[model samples]
Target: MTTKNLLVELFVEELPPKALKALGEAFSTTLADSLKASGLATAHSAVTAFASPRRLGAHISAVRSQADDKPVSQKLMPVGVALDAAGQPTPALLKKLGALGFDAGAVPQLKRQPDGKTEALFLDVVVKGATLADGLQKALDEALARLPIPKVMQYQLADGWTSVNFVRPAHGLVALHGADLVPVQALGLTSGRETRGHRFEAAIDPVMLLDADHYARQLLEQGAVIASFADRHAEISRQLRAAAAREGLTPIDDAALLDEVTALVERPNVLLCRFEEEFLAVPQECLILTMKANQKYFPLLDAAGKLTNRFLVVSNISPADPSRVIEGNERVVRPRLADAKFFFDQDRKKTLASRVEGLAKVVYHGKLGTQGERVERVRAIARAIGERLGGTALAADADTAARLAKADLLTDMVGEFPELQGIMGGYYARADGLGETVADAIEDHYKPRFAGDQLPRNDVGIAVALADKLETLVGLFGIGQLPTGDKDPFALRRHALGVVRMLVERQLALDIDALIDTAVKTFGPLVADPARTVGLVVDFMFDRLAVSLRDQGYGAQEIDAVLSRRSSRVHEVPRALAAVRAFAALPEAASLAAANKRVGNILNKSDAPPAAAADPARFVEPQERALFDALQAASAPSAAAFERGDYTASLQALAVLKAPVDAFFDGVMVNADDPALKANRLALLASLHAAMNRVADLSKLAA
Candidate 1:
């Protein structure tokens, strides 16, 4: 029943910077979970993960040295099959007992239990608990096996003949229960108290850990390393902000860059460094990206949020006079900035218009032709959409923008950093003497590249953006390269969601169906059945829309109701949803929804279609007459409000029909004995159904 704190560590060469945090968290969580599963730790046990450039480890508190013995009962076999008719042990029974490390004398100890139609013999045994050493070894193995390693390295062990595969070359392993070494081995190394730290600046060569709880402190004081990834990240952030604050500047905020830097250094020392001011002539995006992506430095920004000539470097070592470190970082970063500047200067020398022809040589997809052909299709779609949105000026700008959007792909700067594709295009378009509208559209066409990202800025941008996304969706779906399961190699889902976001968020007047048809026609014979392709792509976009709406906090029923109308104008979805929510809150909402569902069912089962307008003269029953009058009163105002885009008002106006609709269903039979009466009732119900559903299908709200 003794409990103790535990520590485990795996020392190795520097780990992958980007994957280190995940690896550390996974190792600790999986190891602790395994221990708890095996009853070696209780639910209240606490675990702390530690990760650095050279090590991954965990410290767990309140872990039991050994699990308690447990009583177990296992079914052996049916009673008939285990023993003979004489109540003696048969050969089968003897064999089963022997397999379980039992002898013939143990036969009488077996218990008989009912198992459905037959009674089965059960064996009862007390299982011995696992010692800390044994349990820790199994947990260690499991944790190592489950690590999310980006890649594995194969290296020879100390024995030279033996080799192992791991994220890095494992040089040491440490396992301790309290102050006692648990003596577990992994990666060809045995557990020990000694672990190396800070390859160059450790106060001691092999910093010996005193106890399980002292791991982090010892590493920091004697080993000169910040062992916790989160702590190291926070420390580096603090230093960067403080250092930048002194100069009245701010470090660029990038979580990914911060994480990568944290993993690259064991001990962080933030120092300021500067580049030549002339290099700032190139876009700050170019300079910031080069420094952060290539050199892992944090770029400083001025008050206007413009990139400054200075940047911050997170050094792994600290010296007495840090000027050398600052100068060293500055010296190293100059060439990287120079390369970016060189690429920018070289790229601007040639106009984006000149690169259009080169796109034909670059393949977009094996089946979908080249980027050049894709551009033409996009231009066609963009022009069509723009013409519908605005007359001629907008179409011209959109066409120009769509044609040049991908031209930057061939440029030196973009070729070096593909992430700068659309951004560089905007810059180059302006240099080509294209106006701001065209340049902005060229840049913003790829807007909303990811979830929660911004959409296109202007009307022209919206047109080109829609065209680009539709081209990808239509082209890929046309070639039967549809995404299945989790494998969306072409990011078609993102494209679809992007389209949905633009239509709904921007409130574009363009019809989705018409847009799809325009895009399909642009592809020509490439699509075997343009109609079918259009249908598939539209459905896919709707599916993405449902998910997006759900993520935005709309209920499943609300979304289902709104989408059921298949309203061509996706931009009106939000308004429709708002109306549905407002309607749902009404006291009469549920009854009206239920009545709408019943009315639909009756109309669907009718022998013939209902009349376009109900004949009030044919209403034989008083209830039918009353409902028809109510429908007329509600329909007029509701139709007017709906046309005016006041969806909530339109739906609320229909609330007056709740009483008349309830009375019609209660006192009148829709399928009356007389054919004329039934037809008249069907027509009356049809009118009511249409009136209630102008905003959304109320039947979808029925329980």
Candidate 2:
């Protein structure tokens, strides 16, 4: 029953930075999980993961040396087949007992239990638990096998003839249970207490860990390395903030950049480096991106959030003077910044208008023609959308913006940094003497690109943005390239979600179906069935909208009720869902919803449509007459409120129908013997159904 903390580490060549965090977590969790599953670790054991550029490891607490032995009852075979008629052991029983390492004397101890129509013999035995060494070895093997390795490298081991595959060349493997080294082997290395520290700054060569819990402390003290990835990242972040604060500036906040830098260094020493102030003449985005993406540096920002010439570098070694490190980083970064400035300056020599002609040479997709053709389609769609939103002025600006948008793709700045496509376009548009509206639209057209991202700043931008997204969706869908599962090479799902977000969040009055139709028409003979394509695109958008609404904390029933109506104006969906939520809270909501479902089923089964109104003379039951009167009273106000956009009030108004509806169904037979009576009842039910579902399909809320 003795337990001890366990530690395991695998040291190798530098791992992929982006995959380090995931790899660390997966290795630790998988190792601990495998141990627990084998009963060598308790459920309450604590596990801590450590990862650096060169290693992945785990520290687990309260791991038992061996699991407890348990008595197990295993069914052998049917009693009839195991024993003779005289209750003596048959050859089958003797053979089964012999296979289980039991002798003939053990046959009398077998138990019988009825299993369906026959009795089965069962054997009870004690199962020995796995030893710590065996369990740890198994867990380590499984963990390595299950690692999320981005790529694998095959290399020969020291034996020269033997080879191994791993994320990198494995140098060492450490596995310790408390103070003792557990006998485990992995990646062509045996378990040991020795591991290398920082490549250049280790206090000692082949740092030796004294105990299972001393791995981290020894690494930091003697190895000159911060072994834990999270701790190292936090330390780097702290130093960066402190260094920037001393200069009265703030370091740019980028989690991805932080992680990549953390992975690149072991012991982080923050140093402030600078470039020529003249480089600031280029767009801050250009300089900032060059520093971060190419050099893995954090660009400092002034109080006004403007990029400063000074930047912070996280170095692996800490020198007493630190002057050489600072100067080396500055020298390395100058050319990158110069390249960015050069691209920007060279790009301005030729206007964006000149680059428009070059787009014809760039292929967008094999089936979608050239970028020039796509730009024309986008311009047409944008013009149509702009005219619908605001007359000729907006249309002209949108068309101009759309035409110039793709021109930046050929510019030096964008060619060097593809992420700056739309941004550089906006800059070049302004330099061309185009007005603010056109420039802003050019940049903002790619707005709301992802979830929670901002939408277009102006009506012109909105039109252009909508047009761009619609063109992408319709074009790809027409080519039978619809997104299947997770393989959306064209990002169709993102494009669809962008459209839905703009339509619903902006509360735009545009009709989704009509917009899709317009977009499809812009493709000319490329699309086969414009009408069917419209339906497919609309359905796809609605599906994305439903998922989005659910993520926003709306219930499935509420979303279903509103979307089930197939409301073409997505802007009204939120209001409809709100109304549904309010109506569902009413005491009579359940009955009314159920009654609405009943009415729909009856109408669907009918061969003819219900009459427009119920005849008073044909009403035979008092309940039927009462329901008709209630319907007349509720329908008028509900319809008026719905027209005025008071969806909540519209739905609430139908609550009055619950009693009458329930009573009519309970007391009156809707399919009466008389033809006129049955027809009249159906008509009354139809009117009631129409009144209740003005905002959403109430039947969806029944459950």
Candidate 3:
């Protein structure tokens, strides 16, 4: 019925800030689970974690005083045949009941209520209570044992004692309940009522923790450390943006940088630093890369979005002279930018237009041959993709763009920094007097560099992007570089998604199998076996397409059915989805689906082989003749509509057979004694199959 606050802290040498953030969560979750398993009714809320380079601590709101006690019941099967030979309480039964804590003196009188019923009895038992500290300590110990310490080592204490292995050296441990210390001796730690302040700025030997709230405050006041990472992160962002605003420049928004910065400092001190303006003559990308990749500084940009010479650096310490730190950082970053500038200038000596021929030396992949060879394959594939979408006006231009898309890979600038691959190509292409469409395609072909990024814009760009990705996919599958769980080294998943986005967004009519075949064939002598490569590439695309469609709102089962029956005609998937939606819209569609199930059930149960129904003279009933007539009429319209990709209209035509087929099933017996009559009825079902198979195997749809 009573509750108390719980505090657990791990004190050690400096931990990587990232590890601390993750471990804080692990501690809260694992500890909560352990307490619940012990049957304690505790509200583990208000989890507060604060980590410096040295320690990680979490505080819980309230934990129950003791685990809820319940009387556990046991069933003992009666032993001893014939009950001691006198039908009495056998010695075996007495011993079994005694071992279960049932008091023999207090056993209740037995009573019988019905025939074949035995007497019922019970003995009252009470369980001992456990203290809050006992339960919490057990739970915390279990959780700590499982806490993943990426690195650990043994420690020695002054008392000539050895401690449990740990990452870095363990200094102390603090475990608290309200104002009391819960003693623990694991890992050479004496359960204490105190923890330390920030490693760099602590003035006292140790800060005493009287309570969870005061303990957190003392650490901050003594060492200038913030307890909660969320608050610290907000403060860092505020200061960095303010520092950037002083020069009318903006801080580049980077999630990875923000996360790394959060781990790099306990108390972030934002400062403005500048480089010589002459460095701005280097490309904006080159300047930013120098600051971000090398110095970990947040680059600032001018109002016009140009990279400024100034940057904002966040420091963990508030030094007496911040200007000195700024100058030291500037000295380190200047040389890096100069090197990038040198690479950029040297690369410009060879124009991107001239670099097109140089791609022949850069291998795209062993099986894919050289980048120059890939360009040739892409030129043909892009033209095919372009023509299929009715973009002939720009088809020639798309061919030109695809041919030069990877040309910049040969340039010195892109060679030094591969991230600027397509970007440098676009810049060079435009400078060489290429048309806007051609130059734009050279850049935009790599629009979706990752999942959730924007896709290529124009048809030309989309076509070329698809070509490049498909070639990679087919070539890799031919050589077996397919992805397994989380091991996509070549980013094949992104390429697959790019293909899905192109198909769904561009609305292009493409036979994916044919496209894969074209790409595989382009490999020519490079691919060992084209047939197996084509199948693997086709299957990969289907898997990726299934995932994409499910994300678009289709169920997995439906996607499997559609893909199995029509993966080759991938462009027809949208039409098929529409047909499915329309079939569901019909009021009679439900009943029709039921009828279809009945037909399949009957066919499955039938022992005799079904016969063809081409002989009309075998029809003994008028209903059978009516079914045949309707099937004939339905065939023409359905085939015509399906061929033109009008799936909804095709479904409407198939609906014409509903009445006649239902009449035949109701009036005539399919298993007739007459052989010809039985054969004709089976043929009628065969005709229905032929008609529906033209669109999709309707049998796979859910009833």
Candidate 4:
């Protein structure tokens, strides 16, 4: 059958901007997949997706008008049930054949095949092909049903009380194959070669599409719209940069903001707009957040990344004289900025100390107490960790920062913008004459809010951040509010990951187990079950660490080798992993790894621990004595290297015993006839195992 390109579109009212891109992708992909599965499109067919503020469309190349017939094997029934004792047809067989429009004459052509454990009779037949009309209808219905719409609306059609549910009220449907329209219905509308475009700037309303291949071109030339989402996004990005470049400034790099702007416009016209320079007096974060979140604008930055008075607006319409558009946006944004400034100024009148008492009224969690109680717990944990890392001075700074960290939760600025809790606290700290160390600590306590985000910049910040995350994790786990599947209401995974990054990246001397203990102890009587909760929290942190390691490109075996030890000192994990990777590359590594596994198996099968160390006087075989001497000689340098944290060198120093280990295993049996000799050999193997696995368990490297 000859094939033709196909195009389909659904035109509607303005879509939700944040979900437009995803909706377009899901619609086009699901449609293409359904067509391919039904054999109406081949594997090599090309699919293009088009989306804008008013429409979603898909264009697929090399689609067939009819799918080819396929031969199918149909299992009739078990042979035992289909035939009589003499192998003649029975009533059951005759009834089954009759239902299939067949007679006894067709039995001679039937094939017998094994089905599970019984022989079954099968009939071979050709299934009819589907026409383009039926196939396209099914594909369109599947695509609409599978769309990832967050919410749907139910509205009545033009016919009195008949209603349909969709993401939005559909106004039209377009489906075309080559130059002809395909008959398909959706949302009480039939397919046509007509779609509406840019409501204001379109040169033609209800734009007439000529053919499947001319949809995009016709829409662009006559409809005054850029139909492709990606093309529109790239065009807006280019214009924003070009406009910003002329002023010697750079636009803020926010992909999400760019995407939302692209979804808000059908024909993008980037224009430069500005707010009063006086607005720059506020912190750039507040100004940028207000402009981007409240007004959907992009704030420009100087070379030093300082916020500028001028910003860019992506307007849907482009007129000859654009001053009015710029003025209109500026006028709308000024009051928002003024409100932010008012909040900031009024908040500074009272100190953080005064606001600290107000936290008692704010509930953190029902099971857990108020934010005030949580702050006290964080302060205790932070001070304890600080004292371990630095001394009294660091502890004092961390304690002070932790106490006031949540004070901003009561500030007017933070009340207006909950995302600015920590940020506003830092500003208030600076204005209150607190040192930069305390201010930075308060600001950075929420560091690493997501994956790939930076950790705290200083020791004080690290201490407080660690305390805050630990408190959340332990408190939630204690109350049985652990994350299950994907429902992480409190983002416990992120908190656990934040703890992992700080400990590993900072190379802190504190142990993961010890830190959990500290956080639990600080909660005092609040934690319901500290012992069980500590175990759960520890396991949770390790799981997060494994995920983090995998994301960094380490293989499973290498991770298992090091993590099997379950070392409390998580800071040493990276160096330990590096050591194991180096050791696995040696020529004798396979033999040594296997031998280490064998030795471990031998030691574990014994009834009890070896009573004494291996003695040279009891060594009767030459290979056994050779292995003992080699281990004695290699012990010093390996021990010295491990003491100084040279994990790679420590593991490498023991590679010299590979030959002796192989020979000793081959020449001697660990379980000898004599009890004393057996104990001696087991002791010798135990010594070798200890020295080899100091960095990582070599047995884990065995296949």
Candidate 5:
């Protein structure tokens, strides 16, 4: 079987920058996968993806011209149905064989095999494989059908009456197998050896590709285009660093922005541009965001990490003069920076306190009332949390921060850039002379807006952050606005995960359930059912916590063993998980876990509660006496260590009961036919169960 490297390209209008990377990845992988599935490509086939603003392509190595033919034995039908009692083919069998391209003469090749309870007749035949043209066409069709297109546009083709739907207008399609042209058609375009290069800078109007192996080289050398997205990105990074290094400044690092810029240009040419120093009077965040978001430029930073007026521009064309390109970019960025500065200047004209009244007109949610109302609820929750975490001063600061947190929503700065909500508020807070604690808290309240994001830096911020997230969780849960699988329009799961991170990572001594209750009360009548919503929100948070821990590499049983207790001390959960993991590795762990499971089953089936302590005089069995003594000795050390918060040592202390527990269950009949003896034994077993499960439910680890 002869194999060749294949190259395929689809040229279209410029793609959506943010989606280009995903589109490119999906295109190459899906095409290669479809080829492999059809047996045209093997597991060793090497695939490289090419993506630019106007094209998506793939280069695959070791693709066979035609797949290998294979012999297949296919079942026809049951013997009784296919043949008569005369042991000859029936009319139905003849019809089936005719449809399968077989005939009466081929019936001699039929074999019998037992299928379930009946025997079936099978036919063995050699099947021809798909040729390169057919396989590549099928692969291309599938790849286009599933490109993760963000949006589709329907336009009429050149025929005027026929229409096609695609992410962008399709202009060209290229399909080459080594030096040979594979006949394939897509979007009304036939495969060709011609493809256009850069829109403006290509040396040739259309670069004539020679073979599959030279596609990338020809594009870069003669076409002024970097065909590989990864190569283009690395080239841009290298140029940006080199351009910024001349002035002893560093380019602001943003992966998303870099990827978007790479998608915008075919070949990158990094150039330095600058803005007026007066614009630097505004917050660096405002200037940086305006440049990056609006202009797609990288801001430069000094050695001290302070934003500088100079920025780097990734130009699509490298002009000999280059001064005009630099000037044009600088001119384009000036207005955007001016708008940011104007918004900042107009915002700080009034203190954050003045904006508090304006939030009443801003709706936080339809069911949750206005932002003003939400702010009041947050203030109450924050005050309560602060009072618990600290004494008096922390509570006062938390209340102030919570009240002013959403006030920035009404400011001109935040209205122009919503991502700067909390950040701008911090700037305004300081300008109003509200002190560093209040300013930092206002900024840090939204600290953990995403996964791996930091938590609040101060106690005041922790209180307000916790209160804000709790209010949202409880209020939305009460309204039945919960997140479903994949569709988290409200970001409830993220909010819940944020709360979990703060509680566990911050090690705050806060009960999530109690906080939910407090938050529910603050909602007044806004929450439909406060009591029920409390439990729902608590469960959702713990579920998120379990997922977070599992993602952090903790085992399912280890997490389940700790969380099954429904303990409110979330801060202690990590330590509990650590202790459970340690206990699981002990020599006596299996027997103890199994015994703990049996004890729980026995106690659950009994009608009466086990006594707090077993009556030793009624312990008629020596096995019961021995188990009771072992449990008594184990409980003391476990209790001492638990009081000191040494969960590992505490759980490890219960290992002494394994031998006596096994003996008791093996030699003594728990239901001794005497009600009092049974009750006492239940009491003894209950005590043992309690001692073993102080940190986590040991039964969850049982096999």
Candidate 6:
């Protein structure tokens, strides 16, 4: 029972930082799955990846020896014996066994019990074990040849050369199982124990990787590339943080830039650089963005929390003089900030109000119309959402902000850098002498640029945000651009989640359905087809909301039951989901679900609605009378509680009826011979349905 370690490294030209991070994870998971499917489960198998802008490498551990043969058993019955008295085996049993490759003699042997009344048979079918290399090679080759590198190229010269391309040209590959090289080749790469290191810094020596532990150390000292992304990333952060701390400034925590930095260097060398103190006169955000977006430098600030004219940059190579490196980076960053400052100065010359008219020429989408038209639609929808939330009059600024929010998208500043979309608009709004509220709304409207980003704080901001998200969702879905799988071309999923957060976090009394309806109507004239837009909006948002709810610990079945009712209200779904969860928590809840199922079952079988209420004069059973009186009392508390959103109270009230329900079912026959008694029992079950339906259709939940 010897274990083998496998190492595979692909050195390539510089890859996009984001792509490298994702590929590392995908490679590891896919490798594990490939191993499992190959029937090679050793004590442990893991994929460890090392990524830089230049290369991506994976090291696997304890890759099992050839898969071991396992004993398999097959049940067998003679064709004649499998047949019934009709002289044929049971058709289902015969077909199943036949498809499983069963033969009478080859089948597993079975014996009769002491009773010896029935015959039995079985077969032990021994499968030949495969060499671990046999399975491992195929899995490795297929994974390497068709790895999940979304973008690839073809790189073969003519005349039978291996010519597959990936994220970048695969220069060299190191593949090994223990000390032996596994015989697999792809993309002109032949599996071997030798690997190349530090594409630019180290010699192209034939370095042999003998084992996982040894392999890591060799790559660290002689190979020159920190093959572990996690190790490299931590080292970069440590150096960057220390350098920034020496200058009495805090490093801006940018996860995106951190990832990029991880890809940019091998042996990270962090150095602090400074710009002119006067540059701090520019907006803090502008300076930070210029450094991060333009130069990929980590911005540093002083203890007073002000920009210190200092920044930290990580370099792959440790230069002869670190001072020279710092100066060189400063030289590059200075002009980028100057360009930003120039854009800021030029943009402030014209007020956002004056520039607002410029949106008419900016096409948002050729099919959806101009930015100006989109603004109008956003304003109208925001106003509608505001009114729905009981803030109709106070929402005036929201309308104004929505009208000018996209004005900056046409401004020279935004044109130079589209990432500054709403941000540039906010600056222009402030320069135009608009009130703080309007400018802030414009800025905060896009506050949450991505997942986990801060949401809008003001009602006006929330309204405009909702309007923007809904319009995009409805417009795209109307044109059939809905997100499928990872292909969210328009980021519709993020937008939908934004709407959900707005309602839940801001506690906005928004009926998502109503807002979606308003959005659909506002775009009705613009959309190619109006009828499909409404349904698309509803289904799309429900899907996004379902994901959001599930992340919040809601059961899928409960979400399904609540959403199945087609409740357009976002605020209510959470409440309904809460009620369903609480109802489920009841000791009697499972029994109640089962009870409702029984009721549904009986109704389906009867295929008839309950009979008319029993005539009081003909009411003959004491149990029936008690059930009727209890139903009247139970309906009051549950109905009142449900109306007030007191779902807990409603469920508690329902619990009071569980006892009576069980007793009535046990002591009383629902289909009694007496028509009067039968009607009363039917009325009782119908009453339960009405009460339960207020919270959720409990029957839809699994018992």
lDDT (10s digit) by residue, model 3, range 1-703: 7666777777777776556667666766677667666655354455666555666667776666676676643334432321456646555556656786543442333222222354333333445455666766776777667777666667676677655566667777888777777766556677787777766776664888777657677777875677666667888899988888777789999877776677677778998988889888777887787688767899987788878778999888888889898888888888888898788777767766687788788887766688888889888888877777656866787788898898888877787778888877877787788867877788889867876788876778888888888888887878888899989998888898888777766676688888888888877877888999988877777788888888889866456546767556677887777786677567656655556656666666667756654577777789878988888888888888988889889877878677887798899997788776766676677666667645555566645
For residue 669, model 5's alpha carbon misses the true position, in angstroms, by 0.8
lDDT (tens digit, per residue) of candidate 1 on 1-703? 7799999999999899999999999999999999998899989999999999899999998998889999999788898999899988889988998998999998889999999999999999989989888999999999999999999989999887998999999989999889999989999999999999898899987999999988899999999999999999999999999999999999999999999999999999998888899999998888988898989999999999998999999999889899999988899889988999899999989999999999999999888899999999999999999999997989998999999999999999998988898999999999999989999999999988999999999999999999999999999999999999999999999999999999888888779999999999998999999989989998998899999999999999999999988877999999999999999999999999998898888888888998788788887779888988888898999999999999999999999998888898889988889888788778888888888989999999888
How high a TM-score does candidate 1 get? 0.96
Q: Judged by TM-score relative to the true structure, which candidate is superior, 2 or 5?
A: 5
lDDT of each: 0.92, 0.92, 0.74, 0.93, 0.93, 0.74
**Residue 622's C-alpha lDDT in candidate 6?**
69
lDDT tens digits, residue span 1-703, model 6: 6767777666677777767787776665666667777667553566677666666566777776677677775555544465568744466555566676754432234332222455544446677566656766676566665556777776663446556657777666666676777666656666666776675566435566775557778877777778788998899889888887776678998898999888777788888788888777667778888789878999887777777788898988776788888889999998988887888888888778787788888788878888888888999987887676656564687888898888887667788888888877777787778877788889888756677899886777878888898888888887777788789889888888888887777766666666877888887666777767777777777788888878888887798878777765567777787888888888888777777777767666654677545444555666666767776788899889988988777866776667766777777777778765676667667767767777777877854
Tens-digit lDDT string for candidate 4 (543-621): 9999999999988988999998999999999999999999999987888999999999999999879855798899889
Q: Quote the RMSD, in angstroms, for model 5.
A: 1.2
Model 4's TM-score against the true structure = 0.98
Off by over 4 Å in 3: 17-20, 41-46, 49-52, 73-138, 145-168, 200-205, 240-250, 301-310, 318-328, 352-416, 431-438, 597-664, 671-679, 687-698
Give the Å error, residue 603, model 5.
1.4
Q: Write the per-residue lDDT of candidate 2 for residues 1-703, one digit (tens) a residue.
A: 7899999999999999999999999999999999999899999999999999999999999998898887999889999899899989899988989999998999778899898999999989999999999999999999999999999999999999999999999999999999899999998899999999998999998999999899999999999999888999999999999999999999999999999898888999999998899999999999999898998999999999999899999999898999999999999999998899889889999988999999999999899899999999999999999998899998999999999999999998998899998999999999999989999899989888788899998999999999999999999899899988889988888999999988888899998888999999999889887888898999999999999999999999899999998988999998998899999999999999999999999999887888998899988889998998988898888999999999999999888988888899889998888888888889988888888888999999887
- List candidate 1 segments past 4 Å from native: 83-90, 101-119
lDDT of 5 by residue, 1-703 (tens): 8789999999999999999999999999999999999899999999999999999999999999999898999999999999999999999999999999888998888999999999999999888998999999999999999999999999889999889999999999999999899999998889999999998899987999999999999999889999999999999999999999998999998999999999999999999998899999999999999899999999999999999999999999989999999999999999998899889889989999999998899898988899999999999999999999997889999999999999999888888899998999999999999998999999989879988888988989999999888888888899999888899887888888988888888898888778899999998887877889988998998899999999999999999999999999899998999899999999999988988999899999989898888999998878888998888888998999999999999999998888898899889998878888888888888888888888999999999
Model 2 CA deviation exceeding 4 Å by range: 78-93, 112-120
- Window of ten residues with lowest summed lDDT in model 1: 612-621
Superposing all C-alpha atoms, what RMSD in Å does each candidate have to the true structure?
2.0, 1.6, 5.3, 1.2, 1.2, 6.2
Residue 333 displacement in candidate 1 (angstroms)? 1.4
